[model samples]
Target: MMRQRILVVDDEPQIQRFLRPALDAAGFDVETAATAAEAKRLAATRAPDLIVLDLGLPDGDGKTVIETVRAFSSVPIIVLSARDQEIEKIAALDLGADDYVEKPFGIGELLARIRVALRHAEPAGPLPGPEAFGPVVLDRDRRTVTRDDRLIHLTPKEYDLFVLLADNAGRVVTHGTALQRLWGPAHKDDAQYLRVLVGQLRAKLGGEAASLIINEAGVGYRLVTS
Candidate 1:
């Protein structure tokens, strides 16, 4: 069986050393780079299945690397950083990272996050048809959303949130789950971000579609099809 390739981008030699062996033991083919430039080069040339990136690179900010790689590839990226600030975490997610891990994190948790990202990135065989509630139709395969046959534009974050609800249509998807899925483990307690996104989705998917999303106070939101 072939192994999934993972590129580790961090300026700290100690981190690179620790991650390479651990990830190798975890069944991944790991490659390491110390600078953003090298990271981008390896990403393009090596075509890694996932990336474990550090925010502070020697040559440039890791966010820039995320933006640049996002322009050409959708390879799952899990950021490894020391900065645990909510703004920093949100910024990386908004920019296109698949997940984020704060420094001094557990290896077990980091591995779990990597697994989740890889699972989401994998192409599934023959998914069910788009889920519809009223005029709003969500096509998970294409990641395209439409209402009444008219395309509704949503930012990456908004589209992600919408898909999360639509995936569990009629069932409540808790705020913590949504935040963790879209943002990362670090932002699970940040319900305000979820609130803003739900509001934006409601506005974009106006009228009946807006009503389709029912927010349960202090709990979560559910997509109502019936």
Candidate 2:
């Protein structure tokens, strides 16, 4: 099989130097861009399988790169930034990034996230049956959730929230995206509403199964399928 191509967009030479060989060693075909303009050009023409982007670009903010790329492609884009502010993360994610990795990050963690993004980008196959996370099983066709063969009831909003997380299992679902999907664009910044819905859903899932919903502080939630 051909190695998956990763477009690394960062203005810092050291970051390029650090990630090029690392991503190559990790079995990816790596390409680098040092400015937002070049990043957008390469993204449009190169057909990279994934993109590792830095928010601080010499020509423009990385978020614009995300917005531009997202306009035409669903290829996974993972933000690699030094900015740790919650707003920065939310903006990147809401703009269509698949994942965000803070600067001074571990190579192992970054690699793991890259793998998850690649996996998520792959074409999904038909589900054989109800999707299970730990002891909780969600039967989307039947619109029911069950834990250990016992029925677990959920309100409409709670069910929608769970479905969103479950569909994006193993990846962070940003607060903005979740709220907008569940409550429309007007409530996109209403993280508290998401929190309450999550709590209610977790309570219904109950016991060890409740742990399936993993919280990414200041970011969003991830559903642990395994």
Of the candidates shown, which would achieve the greatest lDDT relative to the real structure? Answer: 2
Backbone clashes, candidate 2 = 0
Tens-place lDDT per residue, model 1, 48-82, is 99999999987889999999999999998988999
lDDT score, candidate 1: 0.85
Please, what is the TM-score per model? 0.62, 0.91
Question: Each prediction's Cα RMSD?
Answer: 10.0, 1.8
Count backbone clashes in candidate 1. 0
Q: Where does the lowest 10-residue lDDT sum fall in candidate 1?
A: 166-175
lDDT of 2 by residue, 1-226 (tens): 9999999999999999999999999999999999999999999999999999999998889999999999999999999999999989988988899888898999999998999888888897776379888898899889899999999888888888888998788889998889989999999888889998899888888889889999999999999868
Model 2 TM-score (2 dp): 0.91
In the predicted model 1, the residue pairs found to clash are none
Off by over 4 Å in 2: 124-128
Cα shift from native, residue 111, model 1 (Å): 0.6
